[model samples]
Target: MSEISQAGGTLGAGDRNRSLTYIFGLMLLVGFGSPAAGLVDVPITFFLKNKLHLPAHEVANFRLVAAIPLYVGFLFGFARDRWDILGRKDRGMMMVFASVCAAAYAGFAFVPVSYPMLMAAVALSAVAWSFARAAEQGLASMAGQQLAVTGWMSVIWSMAASVPYLGAYLIGGALSQALEGRTAEQAARTLFLVAAGVMGAMALYSAWKPKFLYSHLKAEAHADRPLQDLARLFRHWPVYPALAVWFLWSFAPGSGTALQFHMQNTLHASDTQWGAWNAIFAAAFIPTYLVYGALCRRFTARTLLFWGTAVGIPQMVPLYFIHSVDQAMWAAAVIGLTGGVASAAYIDLLMRSAPKALQGTIMMTAGSLYWVAIRFGDVLGTRLYEQAGGFGACVIAITVVYALIVPVLLTVPRSLIATREGEVLPLEEPALEVGAQETLHA
Candidate 1:
C-alpha cells in the first residue's frame, strides 16, 4: 500500500477542485428546490397576504406550521446516516426524496385552496425536503473534510444559497403580480406547479450522478451503527460550539416576517419593491462571501470567528436607521454585507467540527436548530413589533443575540483552530472512525 495524501489522497488537487465545482452546482439546484427560496416563498406569501388577507401575526403562524417538519430534521438525518437507501447511499436518498418533493408540490397544485391544506401540504413537502437536505449537506461536508477544502466548500454552499435570491426574487415577485387576475385555486396550481418543476429537475440531476459524487458514494462505508455514532457525536466537544453559533446567528428577531411587515406597514413598501430589496441584499453577500473564501485559506477558525462575529454584532444596526423604503433597500445591502463573512465562517466551523461518519446527523441537527431559532424569533419579533418599541426593539434584541456568540467562540476545540489548508490537531477523545479515511487513503 502507498501513502495516502493527508486529505485522503484519493483525489488530487485538480480532482478536488472539480468535485467542489460539481457539489456547488448540486447545492444550487437544492437551494432553488428549498421552499424558503423565492421560487416557492414569494408566491406563498403573496397568496396569504393579498388573497387570504391575513395579518402579519397570522402569516407568521402559517410559516411556523409549514416549518414544523424542519424542526425535527435530525431524525431525517439519522435515517440517511443509518440506511443505505437500497445500497446506493446518498445518491439514492437524494433521488427518491427529490421525487417525493416534486410529487408533493404537484399534489398541492391540484388541491383546493385552503389555509390548512396549504400549511399541511407545505409541511409534508418540508419533510421530504429535509431528507434531501440531509443527503446534500452530508455529502458536501464529508467530501470537503476528506479533501481539506472546508473553507471553499463553505463558500460554495453559501454562494449556491445566495445566488438564487438575485433572480428568483425578481422572478417570484413578477410571477406573483402575473397571477393577480386568477382565482385562488388557479394561482395555487400555477405557483406550486413551478415549484414541482424545479424539484423534478433536482430528481433528474440526482439520477445523472456527477463523477465526484459517484466516487464519494463508492468510498463511503456501508455499515452504520446509529447508537454508537450518536454517542460519539454527543461526546465530541467541537460540535457544541458550532451548534451554538448556528442557533445564535440565526436567531435574529428583527428579520423575516417582522421586517416584512415593518416595510409594508411603516415604510409603505410594495411587494415588488420588497423583492427588489431581497435581491439587492443577496447580491451584496456574493463579494463578501468570495472574500471570506480567500481569508479562510490564511486564517485559523478562531481568528476568523472573532472578527466575523464582531462584524455581525452591528449588522442589525442598519435597520434602526431605515425610515423609508428607499433607505430600507440600501440598508438591506449593508445588512447582507455585514453578515456574509460571518455566515460563511460559521459553515466552515460546522464542516470542520463534524465527525466523519455522522456528518449527516450533525449537519441536519444544526439545520434543525436554525429553523427552531428562526421560528421562535419570528414569534418574538411579531410580539415586539406590535407591543414593544416596534422594529427598533427587534433590532436591539437581534444585536444583543449576535453579541452572545462571541463568548461561544471560546468553547471550540483547539483541534479546529487550524486553517483549512492545515490538518486538524490530534484529539484525546475517542476516534470518529478508522474505515472511511483509511479506505480513501488506501
Candidate 2:
C-alpha cells in the first residue's frame, strides 16, 4: 500500500494524484455533456409548448413523464457497477455511454415534431446521463479518499460543468433577442444543434484521452449485498435522519427553476437581463466551493452543514421583499453561494457515512430520492407562489423547511467526520492493503 501525507493526514496519495489526473480529464468531457443535456431540454420543452401548440400543463406533464425513465436510469447505476463492455475498464464503458448520449442528442436536434421520437430521445439521454453521472461519482469517490477532498473534487467538477451553462444562457439570450422574428421552433432547433455540437466535442475528448481514465476503473465487489442488507445500512440511527436532512435541504429551493418566471414577471426584467443575473448566480458558486474546501479542512462536516443551512436561511427569507431586479439578482447570488456550500457539505457527509465499496450505490440511491423530493417540492412551491400573490410566501415556506432540517443535519455523529485530526484516524495497514488492491482492480 502506498501512502501520501499532506497537512499531517495520511491517505492514498499515489491514487489521489492518479484520480485527480483522471478526474480532470473526465470532467472536461463530462462538463460538455452536461450543458448539452440541459440546453436541449430547455428548448425541447419550449418547442413542445409554444411551437407544437401543446398546452402548458401538458408540457409540465412531460416532467412527471420524464421522471420515470430518469429514476429507472438511476437504478441502472447498480447494473453499471456490475456490467462491463468489451472486457474493458469502467472508463471504456463510460466512453461508450457518452457516445450513445451524443447520438441521442443529435437525434433530438435533427428529428422533427414526432412526440414519440422526442420522448424516446429524452429517455435515451436520461439513461446516458444517469450512467455517466454514476460513473463520474464513483470515480470521484475513488479519487477523494476523504470528505474534504471529495468536496474539492465536486466543486471542480461543478465549475467545469457550469462554464458551458453560463455561456449558453448569456449567448442564447442574445441570440433569442436578435432573432425575434424567427419562429420559436427555429430558435429551439438552433439551440439543440449548438448543444449537439458541444456533445460531439465531449465525445471526441473522451475518445482522445482514454488512458487517463482506464487506470482508474474499479469493479463493485459489494454487488452481492442483498437488497435488505443495503436498505438496512440506511436504517440505522443517524442514517435515516441524515437522509431526511438531505431530502429537505434539496427540496427547499428545488423550485428555483420554476421561480425564474416569477422573477421575470415581478421584476419586469427582459430575457437578457435574466440571463445576465443567472450568469452572476452561477459565477457566485465558484467561491463557495473554494470556501467549502477550506472550511472542510478546518471544521467537521457536521459544523459545515450547520453553517451552510444557517447561511441559507437569510438567502431564502429575503426573497419575499425583493421588488427590483437588482435585489433579485443579489438574492440569486446569495442563494448560489449558500446552495453550493450546503450541497458540498451534504455530499461530503453522505460520503463519510458510507463504506468505500458501497459509496456509489448509497450515493445513487440518495440522489434518486433527493431528485424525487426536489420534483415534489418544485410543484408545491410553484403552486404556493402562484396562489399567494407574492414571493414572500414562497420564501417563508422554504425557510421553514430549512429551519427544520438544520438540527437534524447537525445530529450527524462525529464518527462520520472524516477529518484526520478530529474523528477519522489513520487506517490500519491491512485495511490500507485491501484498499490498495481495490484501487488496482478499479
Candidate 3:
C-alpha cells in the first residue's frame, strides 16, 4: 500500500508538469493564430470592400460565401478524430494548416483581376483557418482539466491576438496615407501581402517546433466521435434557448461589419482616421474581460447574461445620433466594451450549458449559427441601409432588435448551469439523442 501511494504521487506530479507545459504551448499557438486572423479580417472587410467598389449588399453576399467553408471545416473534426494526418502530431497538423492558410492569403494578395479568383482564395483561406482552429481548440480542451481555466486561457490568447490589429491599424493607416495617390486596390493588396508575410513566418515556426507547445496525448488512446452527432446534441430543451441568445447576440454586431464601410463613405472618414477609430474599438475589450472574470466569481451566469443584454441597449441607441466620423468612432469604441463584456458573459453561459466531450462541437455549432445570423442580418441590414436612405434609420432598426433580445435572454433558466464545472450530465444526452432518434425515425 505504501509503495502504491508513492508511485501514484510520482505519476500525479508528472501529469501536473506536463499539463502546465501544454498550457504555455497552447498560449503561444493561440497568440500566433489570433493575431494573424485579426490582421486579415480588418483589411479584408474594410479595405477590400472599399477597394473593390462593391455595394454593401454584394459585399455581404461574398462574405456569406466566404463563411461557407468555415462550416465545412467544422465537419472536419470527425476526420481529425479518426485520422492521424500528421502522424497523431497536433502541432504538425497546426503547422500544415497554417502554411496552407498563408499560401491562400498570398494568393489573395498577388492574384490580379476577376472577383471569382478572389472568392476562391477566400474559400481556401477559410478551409485552412478551420483546420487549425479545430485542432487548436481540441488540444486546448485536452490540456486543461478545468473548463474555467481553458476559458481564461482563451481570453488571454484573444487579448494577445488583439495586439496585431492595433499594429495593423497603425501601420495600414500610415501606408494608406502615404500612398494617398494610389488606387484603393493597390493599397489593399499591399496590406494583404504584409499580413501574408506575418502569417507565413508563424507557420514556419509551428513547423519547426512541431512538438513545442502541444499537450502530450497518444492519439490511439483517445476515442473517436462523429461530427454529425452535434446537431442531435443541440436539441435539448436548455440548449434551444441558450443557442437562441447566441444567435441574436451575433446577429446584432454582424451589422457592424457593414457599418465600417458606412463610416468611410457615409461619414467620409479617411482610412487613417477609420483605422485610429477601429484601434480604439478593438482595444476597449481587454479591460472589460478582466472585469468579467472578476464578476463571474460573485454573480450567476444568468445575472451576467441579463446585465450584458441590458448594457447593449445603450450601444445601438446612441448610434442614431452620430453625425461625424469622430462620433462614429467613439460609438464603435463604446460598443466594443459592451460587446466584450457581453461576449465573455455569453461564452461563460454557453460553457455552463454544454458538456465536456461536446464542448468544441457545441461551441463551433453555436459559432456557426451566430455567423449564419450575422450573414442573414448583414444581407437584410445592407438592403435596409440602402432603402431607408441613411445610417440613422438602420441604427434605429437594429437597436429595436437589440431591445427584443432582453426577453429572449430571459428565457434561459437557472437549471441548465450544470456544465459550468465541465460536468457531462446524463440528462444533457437527451438533447443529442432526440435529434438522433428523430433522424432515425424519419
Candidate 4:
C-alpha cells in the first residue's frame, strides 16, 4: 500500500496535502453551518439584547439550551460509528444531516424570534449540526491517519473553527447591519434565510459527494461491536486526564456569555466594534496556528502543552482590567497569540489518545466535554458575574482554573506520549462484523 495514497495509489506529500485540504473544508463547513456562532454570533447576541432585552444570565440560559445537544453529541457519534446510513457510512449520513439542517434553518426563518420559538429552533439546529459535525470528525480522523497528516490535524481543525470567526467578525459587522433596519421578525427572516442558504449549499455539496472520502481506506471492524468500543472509552486511562484537561480549560464561569455582555453593555461598544474585537482576536490565531503546526512537527505534546497553558492563563487576566474597546482588542490579540500552542497541543493529545476505531466516540466525547463546559460555564459565569464581584472575579477564577490544567497533564498515559512522538496507535478492531453488507457500498 502507498504511504500517502497517490495517483497510482502510492501515498505522497501532495496526496496528503490534498486530503488535508478536503478534511479542512469538511470541518470548516460543519463548524460554519452553525447559525449562531462565530461572526454570526454577534448578531444572535445583539438580537437577544435588542429584541428581548435579555440580561446576561438569561442569554446564558438560552445558550445552555442550544448547547445541550452538543453536550450529548457522543450519542450521535456512537450512532455514526455503529451503523451506516441506509447501508452507507460517512457519505449517506452526510447527505442526510446536511439536508435536514438546511431545512431546519429555512423553517426557522418563518418563526418569531420570541424566546420559546428561538429556543426550539436553536435546539433543532444544534442536534442536526452535532450529528453532522461528529460524522465529519470520524471521517477526518480515519482519513488523517491514512494520509499521515495526523500530526497537524489540530492546527487545520482549529483553522477551520477560527478562520470563519475571523471573517465573521470582519464581515459580520456588515451582516448585522444588513439586518438592523428590519424589525425583529423581519431580521430573523433575513438572517436565518442566509443561514438556510449556506446549509443548502452544504446539502448540494454532500449530494455530489467526494469519492476520495469513501476511497481513503477500509474501516476497521468496530462497527458491529459499538458497545464494546464505547466500553473501551473508560478502559483507556489517558482519556480520563485528557478529558479532565478539556473540561477544566473550558469551564470558566460566565466566560462567553457574561464577557460578551460586558463588552456590549459596559464597554459601550458598537456592533461593528465588537465584531472588530472578535475579528482581531481571531486574526491573532492564524499565524499562531502556522507556528504551532511547525512546532508540533518538531516537539513533543508535553513540551507544547506545558508552555502553551503557562502563557495562556495570564493573558486571560487582562480582560478583567480592560476599560475600552481598543484595550479589549489588544488584550484579545495577546490571548489569541498565546492560545496557539495549547490549542494545537490539546488536539494533538486527543488525536493521539483516541482509539483509531473509536475515533468518533473519543473525539466527540472530548468535544462534548468542551460543550458541556461551555453550557456550565455560561450559567456559572453569568451567575458569578451577577453575584461574585463582577467581571474581575470571573477572570481571576478562570486564570486560576487554567493553572490546574497543567498538573492534569501528569495523568495522561505514557503510551500516548510515545504516540505523540510519531508511533502508531493500534486500531481497536471490533470482534463483531460491522454493517449489513449492503451498507458497505460506496
Candidate 5:
C-alpha cells in the first residue's frame, strides 16, 4: 500500500474517518441513484416496441431524443463546480434535482400515455437526472483523488451501479409485463408513480448531512471564474485521452438497442428472459470487480490498462455467434466478464486525469461523451444491423473501436500513472503549450 493510503489521507488522523464516511456515502448515492435514473428504460423500450409498435430505428430515435440532457451533462457539472446551490455544494444540487426528478415522475404518473407524452416525461426526467449525476460523479472523483483510492472508488462505482441495475432490469421486466392489463393511461400512471417514489427516496437520502462529506466539499476551493476554468479544462491534454477512452469504449456498435432488438425479435426471447440476461450479465461482473479492487492496489494503471484492453477487445465477439436466447444469456455473461477490468480501469483513469477542483467538470464531460457515444452508437448500430452484414458488422465495428483505444492510451500523461494508488494531480495550473518544461506539476 502507498503511504497516503496507509496514513489514510494527507490532512491528519481525522482524515481516515472522513475518508471512510465519504466513500460509504458515495457508495449509497451511486447505488440507489443508478436504478432511480434507469428503471424506466426497459418499460419505455417495451412500451414503444410492444404497445406503440414502433420500428427499431424509431425506438432508437426515441432513446436519442430522451437522452438529450445526458449528452450535454458537462454543463450541469460545470454548474455544480462553479455554483453552490443554496450554499450546500453537491448535497444541495442532489437534493434539488432529485426533487425535480420526483415531481416530473409524479406529474407523468397521472398524465395520459402517448408517444409524445412519454418522450416529454423521459426528457424532463433526464434533465433532472443530469444534475444529480453530476453531483455524485464529481464528489466521487474528488474523493478518489483526495483519498488516493481511485481503483477502489472505481470498484465501488462499478459494483454499486451494476448491482442496482441488475435488480432494476428484473423489476422493470416484471413491471412491463404487469402493465399489459391496464389502459395506456393507467399503465403510465402506475409506472410513473413507482418512479416518483424512487426519486423521492433519493431526495431524502441527499438531504441527510454527512459532516465529513460536507466539510470536504466546503474545504475545496470553489472556481471563481467559470469561463477561465472551462478554458483551462479544454487546454488540458490528459483529459483528451481520458475522454477518448470513455467515448470509444462506450461507443458500442454491437450493443444497446441493436442487441436488445436482436435478442427479442431475432432470437424470439421474451421480455422476462431479456431481463434475466441483463441480470446474469451484471451478476457476472461482481467477482471481477472484487478482484480488480485488490489488483488495482498491486498493479499500475498502465499494466491494468494493457491487460484490460487485451481481454476487453473480444467482448462483443461472443454476441456475433449467438443464435438462440439461451446462447445469448451465456454471451451476455461472457461480455460482462471480459469487460469488467477495462470498465473499472477506464473509470480509474478518468478520475485520475481530473484537474484539482475541476473533478465535476471533467467527470461530467466524460459522462456527456459517454451518453453521446451510446445514443449515437444506437442510431448507427440499428442502421448497420438492418442494412449491413447483420449483427456481425456491428460486432466488427465495436472491436475496431476498442482497438483504437490502445493508441489513445499512449497519449496520457506519465505523471498521472506514475503511482499505484492515485497521486493527486497538481493543484497548480498545468502548462498550456506542448513540450513545456512543466507538463505536470511536481
Candidate 6:
C-alpha cells in the first residue's frame, strides 16, 4: 500500500496546514484576475463612448485590438509548459505576469488617450491579462482536483468574473458622473494605477507564499517535439466538434456594435441606465452559478449542452422585441439565468477532455476558440445590423445561427463526452473501442 493510503486516517500538523494553503493558492490567482478584467473593460468602454464620442463600431474596433492577442493562447500555454522554474512553474509565471500587468497599466496611465493610443494601451493590457489568465486557469484546473469538485471551480470562476462586471457597472457609472472634464482623464489614470497596485500585490503574495501557491504539476517531464505533440491533438477527432460548438454558439450575427447601438440609440438609454442593464445581467448569474455547480456533478456533458443550449439560444429572442429599457433589463436578466448554465457546462466539458500533459495547452486553446468566435461574430453582427433590418433583423439571424449549435453538438462522439458516469481525459484513446465501435473483418 502507498504510504498515503496507510496513513489515510491522520495527517501531520504541518501537512494539514500546507494542504489547506495549497487549496487557496490554486484559486487565488484566477479569482483576482477575473475581477480585474471587469475593472479594465468598464472604464475603457466609458472612456471611448463618453469621452472620445466614438460610435459603437469604433468601440468594437478597440475591443478587436484587445481580443487579437487571445488568439495566440496556445503560445502562452506552450511557454508555461516548456519552461522550468527555480521554484514552481505556475507560481513563477503568476508572479511574472502580475508584475507585467502592473507595468502595462502604469504605462497606460501616462499615455495620451486617443484612438491609436487607446488601442495600443488596451492591447498591451490585454497581453498582460492573457498571461495572467493562462496562469490562473492552469492553477484553477489543478485546484479542482485538490478540492475533488470540478463543478465548483467553474462556478467560482464565473461568479468571480461576474462580481467585477456588476461592480464596474455601478461604480464605473458613478465614476463617469463624478469625474468630469480633466477629472475623466484623471479617473482613468487612477483606475489604471489601482489596477497596477492590485497586480503588484498579487506578485508580492505569490513570491512570499510560494510554499502555498505553487501548483503540483502532473504533466509528464517533457515531450520529444512540441509540434508533434500539438499535431497529435489535431488528429484527435473530438477537438473538431468542440471547436464547432464554440463557433456556432458564439457566432451571433447581430451582436457587438449592433446590440450596443440598439440599446443606446433605439432604446435611448442613458449611460447610467445602460450600465444598470449590465449590472442586472451580471447579478442574475448568482443563482445560475449555484445551480450549474450542482448540475455539473449530476449530469453528463451532452445532457447539459442539450438543455442549456435549448434554453439559452431562445433567450436572445426577447432582445428582438425589447423596445424599452425595462424590457432590455428583463431580457438581460433572463439570459443571465440560462447563459451562465450553458457557459459553465461548455467549460466543464472542455476541461474534461483536456490532456493531462497538455492541460494548459488545451484549456487555453479552448479559450482561444471562444474569442475567435466572438471576434468573427462581432464583425458579422456589425455588418448584418447595417445591411439587414437593423436590430430585429440581426437578432433573427443570430438566433438561427445559435440554434445550429444543436446540429454541431450532435456531431461530437458520445465517447468524447465527460460526465459523473465517466471521465474523458484527453490522453485516453476515445477514438477506438471506447471512442469508436470495433469493425469486424468481412
State which candidate has the highest TM-score.
1
TM-score of 3: 0.76
Q: Which ten residues in a row are the worst by lDDT in model 4?
A: 430-439
lDDT of 4 by residue, 64-153 (tens): 777778888778877777767855576677778877887898898888678787777778887887777777888776655544456677
lDDT of each: 0.79, 0.59, 0.57, 0.72, 0.77, 0.64
Each candidate structure's TM-score, on Cα atoms with residue i matched to residue i, is: 0.93, 0.82, 0.76, 0.91, 0.90, 0.84
Model 2 weakest lDDT span, ten residues long: 426-435
Best by lDDT: 1
Q: Write the per-residue lDDT of candidate 5 for residues 1-442, one digit (tens) a residue.
A: 4335322223433654465555555455444433223677778888899999998899999988888888888898888777668666677888898888888889888887899998888888888877887888887887677667788788878887787678767987888887788788887787777777877777787777654433333235544677778777877788889999999998997587788888888999888888898888888887888778888868887888889989999888998899999898888899889989998899989988887668888888988898789889989999999999678889999999999999999998877876675455443443221221112111
- Candidate 4 regions off by >4 Å? 1-9, 36-40, 207-214, 223-225, 419-423, 426-441
Off by over 4 Å in 2: 1-18, 35-37, 45-59, 114-118, 146-148, 157-161, 183-189, 203-220, 223-239, 418-442
Clash pairs, candidate 4, are 4-11, 5-11, 87-439, 253-381, 254-381
Off by over 4 Å in 6: 1-37, 142-148, 208-219, 421-442
TM-score of 1: 0.93
What digit string (tens of lDDT, one per residue) describes model 6 on residues 45-94? 77788788887676766676677887787777766655545445566777
lDDT of candidate 3 over 172-275, digit per residue (tens): 56665676677655754775566566556655654543232222222222233453455445454566676777777766533554576677777888778878
- Between the candidate structures 1 and 6, which one is better when assessed by TM-score? 1
Which residue pairs come into collision in candidate 5? Answer: none
TM for candidate 5 is 0.90
Cα error, residue 253 of model 3, in Å, equals 6.9
* Candidates sorted on TM-score, descending: 1, 4, 5, 6, 2, 3
Higher-ranked by lDDT: 3 or 6 = 6
Global CA lDDT computed for model 6: 0.64
